[model samples]
Each structure stands twice: as structure tokens, then as C-alpha cells.
Target: MRDGIPRFVPEDNYGKSFGYQWNLHRLTQLDSYVGLPVSRDRLLRESGWTTDELEGREVLECGSGAGRFTEVLCQTGAAVTSFDISNAVEANATSNGRFAGLRLLQASIYDLPLMDESFDYLVCLGVIQHTPDVERAFKTIFRYLRPGGKFCIDVYAAIVAYPHLRQLLRPVTKRIPPGKLYGVVQSITPRLLPVSTRLSAVPWVGDYLTRLVPVANHRHLGLSDTETVRTWSVLDTFDWLSPQFERPQPRRRLERWCRDLRLSEFEIERIRGLYVVRGTK
Candidate 1:
């Protein structure tokens, strides 16, 4: 075990694209750069959690890529056990490792080497849809929650209109090596993002028009500045294209998964096209 966290090595990185991408923009989603703590607010708002509740609590953060959310969790005074399936854990550790109540682990969600019922709360965001099996990933983390403890998660929603272009293009893009694909996106994103920004401004059909293109649309998320939107655009576009598995879950399917896990107090919020679900064990 390293740093008091068990180790489970993966046969190969199923999410190596994420590993490379997060390390590239490790601090983009972080609040420090924007002075807003957007990730923190999203977590608390979606989870219905308060600083008072997080303080002194034991929290497990799954798929904590590059520690963007881990920084927020640390600020809550919660004892955070953060893990990722990539060397992005190195980036997270470099930035937040010195915090008093944080533990780091590098393991896969399919088989985590942690004790059951070991945490007071669990927070997983922006990760489930990327996993090979969303249900199995959900259950694996749910088993780590203490009875009556809350779990917060978010996944890509199955928007029939959204991702239409991504789906069509992924068959070709997924096969390209991660680095080569990133170079391709880097060349195209600058030109396409501005167009998406303007197209998204149109009324009625603007949303659909923007969705027709694969460039990441942070416009709907209220990010307007040229540089900020561009950064998010590059990061998100790479994120959408590079993953080995991409599954957008339907609302009913998510609810059924919660029921299958015997979780209670289940609440779901549709925030900016992402399905955020919170429930209790």
C-alpha cells in the first residue's frame, strides 16, 4: 500500500486519453484561476451538501482526475481519499498532497482495493459515463459508503440531439492515437469554437445547431470570455473524443441503478445537460 491506500494495478489504461488530457490542463477547471470555485459550487449544489456537513467528514472522491475537485474537497476540511486510474494522480499529489487530511490512491473503478462502508460520503463527477459499465461503477462506489451516507455523482445524459456529431465521428476518431488526435483537435478547435459560440446565440434552433458540431460548447455553461471558453473548448473536445468508452445514461436507467443498489433519498438534477444524481445508502 502507498500512502495508506491500497494499490490495484490495471492491465492497461482504459482512460489513457483522460490521463494525458488532465495533465495538460490540470488547473483549468480549478477555482484558483477563475476565483470562483465553480467545481466546488457544482459539487455542493448537485450533492445538496454544505460545508458544515463536509467538515470533519470522511469523503471518498472517485475518478479524481488531476484533483480539480479534490482541491475543493480539501477546502471543506473533509478527510478526502482521492484516487485516479492515471498518472494524473501525480499532478494531484503535487498540488494538494500536502493537505492535512488527504490520501491518494491510483486504481481502477472496476476493482478498487478499499474497504466497504468506509466513508461518510462519496463524490464522483464527470466520470461514470466514461467507464465501461456505468452500473458496475456505481455499485462499486456505493459499497464504500457507510449506511445512511450520501453519494453524489454526475454522468453524461442521453441527449438524442446532443452528441449526434460525436457519435458519427467517434468511429474514426477513436482509432487515432491520443496524441495525434489531440493535435488534430488543437488545429481545428480555434476555428470552430467561435462559430459554435455565435451559432449557439441564435434563438430556437441555436442549441441544436451548436450540437451538430463536435467542438465543446461552454457557451451554455455561461463561460463567455474568449480565452476561458477556448481552453474549456479544447479540453472538453479532447475529452469527448479520446475516451475508449462513452455511454450517456438515460434518467430512468440512472434511477433504476439507484434502486438496484437499495439506495434511498435519491434526487436527480439536470444541470446544463449533465445528469447529476444524489442518494443515500
Candidate 2:
């Protein structure tokens, strides 16, 4: 183990963008850092698993960027084994290394080192769509879940047929180095935020107008202030443009995967912009 964490993947990979961004914005999405239960609420809502139910259970967390959900899972008293295909594992360790129940690793979903049918529960959030092969990644991780184990995951929803402004610019933005891409997003967010913020209030067309710009503004989401909104905007916008892959799955597709896998009591629904699929093995 290197730096007190197991390393299963190379230091550089397709997830380099995530490693870069999450390390820079290490605590940006943490519930504790934000003084809000944003991560906690989402974890509970999407997984439909309470802390009491998960206490002392084994949970395998994939794509644990900066340990936002790791903190929440560890607090549940679960034996949480979390991994990512990037150096974001370092950031996760920095943020949540103190948690006794947490075990951090740098590993790929397709090649996890753990045994099959080992975990009591599994959760992969804000990650599937970013993988090179979403379906195969899901199947690979699902193999490790024990029978009757609960699993939860979320992917970008393929709801819109037309490309948004972010999609239109991804060809150029994604090619730019992450550092340069972050700089560009940071520079543009301040100028366009007011315009997007203003348009977001214009009733029907307001949301559409805001989408035309590439920057992400979260004023309507009720952040503390404009600066917080800007910070989130820059971070999210970079996230949108810097990923090596950004695939969105349709609701039916998610349903088919669940059915094909024979996952019982599965529910596939759009929650807060992601297609959340949860079920039992």
C-alpha cells in the first residue's frame, strides 16, 4: 500500500480530470464542510437505506470522490470500503481518513480486488456515466454484491434529445487540459452568473435561457451567498466539461439493466437530475 491506501490503478488514467478537480475542491461537496446535509440527505434519499439499517453492514462504495458519501457511510458504523480510479482517493483519505470504519483504495470498477458476493450493500453515486463503459462497469461491480444485498447507483439521465450548451462546448473544453479548462470556467462563471441568475427568474423561458450559457449557476438551489454560488458554479462547470466520458442513460435503459440482472424490488427514477436505480440482489 502506498501512502496508507491500496493502489490498484496507475497514478494517471482516464479519471485524471476527476483526480484534479476533486483534489482542488476537496471539501466542496462535503455535508460537514458546507454546514448542510446535502450529501447526507442525498445518500439517504437515493439509497433508501437508513443509517440504523446499515450499521455494522459491509458497504462497497465505488467512485468515492473526495469521500463526500464516505463520511456519511462511515458515520453509519458500516465497514465502508471505498475506491476510485483516480488520485481522488488521496483527497478522500485526507477528508475521511480518521473514520475507523473506512478503507480507502485507488482501484478501477472493472477490476476491483475484492471477492465476489462479499458486500452486504453497495453504492455508486455520481459516477456511472463518467466511466468508459457504463453497462459493463455496473455489471462488474454488481458481481461483488451478496445475494439479498442492497445496491444503489445514479447516472446522468438521458432526458433531453437536444444538446445543451455544455454538450456543444465539450468537444473543445474536454480537449483543453483540466487546469486550463478550470481557469476558463472560473473566468467565465463570474461574468455569466448574473445573466443566468437573472434569467433563472424569468418564469418559463428563464431556465432555458440559463442553459444556453455554459456556466452552472446554483442560486436557485439556495446556497448561502453569491460567492458560494460562484464557487459551486465553477466547480460543477469544470466537472461537466473535463470528464473523459459523459454518458447519460434513459429511464428504460436503467430499468432493463435492473431486470436483466434479476435485481428484486428495483426502482429506477429521476432524482435531482440523476437517474437513481436501487434494488436488492
Candidate 3:
């Protein structure tokens, strides 16, 4: 393997923005780095899989950006095969390479180098919406799951008739090179965050007004430290704007997809503005 990590896709592709951002903010979202269980909590809640259940099982993690969840998965004593469509695999390896039972690869979700019905569990979080064809990507990954294997995924939720400020700016922001776009986000976040924070406190208008500001302010997340809040704001704001594809799907549509796949015991529910789907094949 090149550089001690398996490479499937070319070093540059549509996920370049993700690769750049994750490498730059390598440790930003990791629970180990943040001294919080944010990543672990989300993984557990969304997957409904306890660490005890995962121990000694096999888990295939797609779109493992910077290994935020990879770190938690590796700690579970599971054999974790984590891959990304971007060079974020490098960042993931840097963060979690030392963990036993962890394998890092740079690969596309559409064309994975794995056997069908091979994995016991598959998880794709905050990823499918970024792919060119969400359904195809889902089916491709699902093919890798063994019979009775469990899966968990989350996608951005569609809001009917709502004018999302991020979507309005993405056309321009996504076209800009990720390195330059990151700088733009950094410069604007400090200025707009204060205003957004103030507006977010207002009753009804606050949510609307806060949307007008492009920066992602995480004041409500209980990050007590001001510097940490600022760092998260800048990182998340860049993440929000720099993606090449950011498709949000309706909850019903996601449920329909699960039905089409004939995934048993499947449920699609909203969690923190994302539609999280969990089921077994």
C-alpha cells in the first residue's frame, strides 16, 4: 500500500474539498481531541449499537472523514475497515492508525474493493448526500453487508420551501478552490458569528435571522470554552460551504429507499436535523 494506506481512487476527485478540510481540521471533531464524547455519542445514538455488541464484530465505515467515528469504532474492539472517497483517509490514519483492528483506505463508495455480503455491520454517516447518486451509493454499500447484517446511515434532511442560506452561497463557494474557500470562511466566521449568536437568542425570528448569516455558530452545543467555540464555528462553517455536492433528502424518500432494499426492521427518524436510518438486511 502506498504510504502505508490502501488507495483505490485517485488522490484528487470530487471529494477534494472534503480531503482538504479534514486534513486541515484533522483533530477538530475527535472526541479524544475535544475532550468530549460528541462523536461517540452520535455513533451510539445513530447506530443503536453498544460497544459491547460491537466488540469482536466487523464494521465497515464509509466516508470516515478524519476518523472522528473511526476513533470510537476502533476503541470498541471491533475489526474496523474505514475508508473515504477523499484523501481524508490520510488524516484518519494519522488519528487512528495505531488502534488495533483498524484498516484505513482511500476508496469511493460507488466502487468499493470488498466482497459482497462480507461485513457484519456497515455505517455511512454524513456521506451519502455528497455522492453523485445517493441511491446507487446506498445500494453499492448495502451489497457489502452480510445477511442479517445491521446498517446505519444519516443524510441531510430536506426542508420544503425553506430558503437555506448555505445553499444560496454554495454555488459560488463550492467552485472556489477549497484552500481559498477555507480562508474566506475563516475571515467571515469571526465577524458573522457574533451577530448570528445574538440573533439565535431571539424567539422566532432568531432562527430565520441566524440562517441569513453564513457562519456555523455552535453556541448552543455547550462548548464552554470561547476558543473551542470559535474553532468549531470556523471549521463547521467551512465544512458547510465547501462541499461540491450537498443533497438533502426527505424523510419519506429515505424510508422508501429502505423499503426498496427490503431492509428488515428499518426505521428512518430525524436526529439533530439529519434523517438517520437504521435497519438489517
Candidate 4:
């Protein structure tokens, strides 16, 4: 298999950009402030993912972005194999150096190189939607999990009432990739709040204007790598500008596909803008 995406050492790139770190730092700050909307820590707490739940189990974390979930899974005592398609792996490797039992690898979701049925628990979060083929990716994940083992994941939701509203913003952000614009907006939008309080009073036009202008200072989680955050954002914007397609399949449609794979669908939840479902494979 190919080596994972090389670590994005922005020291090699950031010198030329303006206000880059501001945008990046602010996004990292946002991460610490809120729980990952994919059921949040509440789901992790309920799933018994605390220390004893993953004890001695073989866990595979697909799309272990920046190692946030990896750190959580690590607390559970499971041996985790962290994987992703981008430089996040290298960032994870660098960020996760102090931790052991972590095997970081980078590769495509549809074509994972590991052997079949290799893990007792497969934790693939925030990844299925970004894949070119969500069905095949699900099938690939199913292959990695042991029989009766669980695979938990959160997918982008199309069924939510505001997607059309969000989708309509595409024209304004048409320069942004439909896939990644949300990531950009989540980070950049919050910083615009000073004027946002004033601007929000306007109609739909207000939000658009707020989004177009870059804020002077952003926030950070302090635990995060400031450089990686900037790189992730710019790349996310680039990714949205050029993507696999416009949007991904809805949650129910993905659920049906999971059914087709003979995977048992056990939990499904509709959060603010995402539909999260986890199952046993």
C-alpha cells in the first residue's frame, strides 16, 4: 500500500498566505468548545466507551481526523489502528507520539489494505459521506469488523429541513466545495459574530455577507496544532471547490444500503444537520 498522506508541515507553505492562521486557529478553538455533533460525548458515554468498554479489544478508527476520537478511544484501553486519507494521519502520528498501541496508516476508504475481519470494533466517524462510494465503503468497513462486532459512524444528512437552505448557499459559496464548505463555515462563521449580531438582523442576505468576509482573529482549542488547522481549512475549501460530486446520499438511503450489506442497524439519530447511525457487522 502507499504511504499515508505526508504530514502537512505548513512551515513549508504558510509564509505566503494572509490571515491563514487566524482562520485556522479559530476553528481549533471551536472544536474544544462544542462536542462532535455525531451524538457527541453523550453517545460515547452511553455506549460504555469509557475505559472498560474497549479494554483488550482490537479497534480500528477509520478517518481518525487529527486524533480527537483516537484520544477518546485510547482512554478505553483498546488497541487502536488510526487511519485516514489525508495528512491528518501524519498529523495524528505527530500529535499522538506520546501514545502507544497506535498504528497510523493512510489510504482510501473504499480500498483499505488490511486483512478482513481484523478488528473487534470498527469506529468510522464523519467519513462515509466524503467517500466516493458510501455503499462500498460501508461494505469495506463491514469486512474489517468481526462478526457481531460494532461499527459506529455519522454521515452527512440530506433529509434535514435546512439542507436545501444550506444547499441554496452553494451559489454564494459556489466557489467552495459542497462537501467541505460546511467545515469552513463552521470555523469561519463563528468569528464573524461581532458584526454578526448586527448583520444577523437582516434577511438571508446577512448570513451570506458574514460568510464572505474573513474575520481578523479566530479561536483555537489549545490542544490543537495551529498549523494543521489552517491547512485543513484551506484544503477543506479546496476540497469543496473540487469534489467527488455535489452532495452525498441521505441518511435513510445509507441505512438501506447498510441493510443490503446484511449489517444490523441498531442506532440512528438525527442531530442538527447530520444523521448518525451505528450498527453491528
Q: Each prediction's Cα RMSD?
A: 2.0, 1.3, 1.3, 7.7
Looking at candidate 1, what is the lDDT of residue 95?
A: 73
Q: Which parts of model 2 have CA positions greater than 4 angstroms off? A: none
Regions of candidate 4 where Cα sits further than 4 Å from its true position: 1-48, 161-191, 194-248
Using Cα atoms with residue i matched to residue i, what is each candidate's TM-score against the true structure? 0.94, 0.96, 0.97, 0.65
* Model 2 lDDT tens row, 1-281: 88999998888799999999999999898888888787898899999889999999999999999889999999989999999999999999999999998988899999989999999999999998999999999888999999999999999888651357889888888889999988888888899888888888998888778778778777745687667778889999899999989899898888888888888679887775678899899
Q: Which residue runs does candidate 3 get wrong by more than 4 Å?
A: 160-162
lDDT tens readout by residue for model 4, 179-261: 35546655664454345445545687764453444432122222244454444444444333333334455767876877777
Predicted structure 4: lDDT: 0.56
lDDT of 2 at 64: 96
Best of the two (1, 2) by TM-score:
2
lDDT of 3 by residue, 1-281 (tens): 68899898988799999999899989998999999898999899999989999999999999999999999999999999999989998999888989979988899998888888989999999899889998888778999999899999998888831366888888899899988888888888888889999998999788678888888887756787888899999998988888888888898788778888888778887875688999889
Local error of candidate 3 at residue 70 (angstroms):
0.2
lDDT of 3 at 215: 83
Alpha-carbon error at 65 in model 2, in Å?
0.6
Q: In model 3, where is the ten-residue run with the lowest total lDDT?
A: 158-167
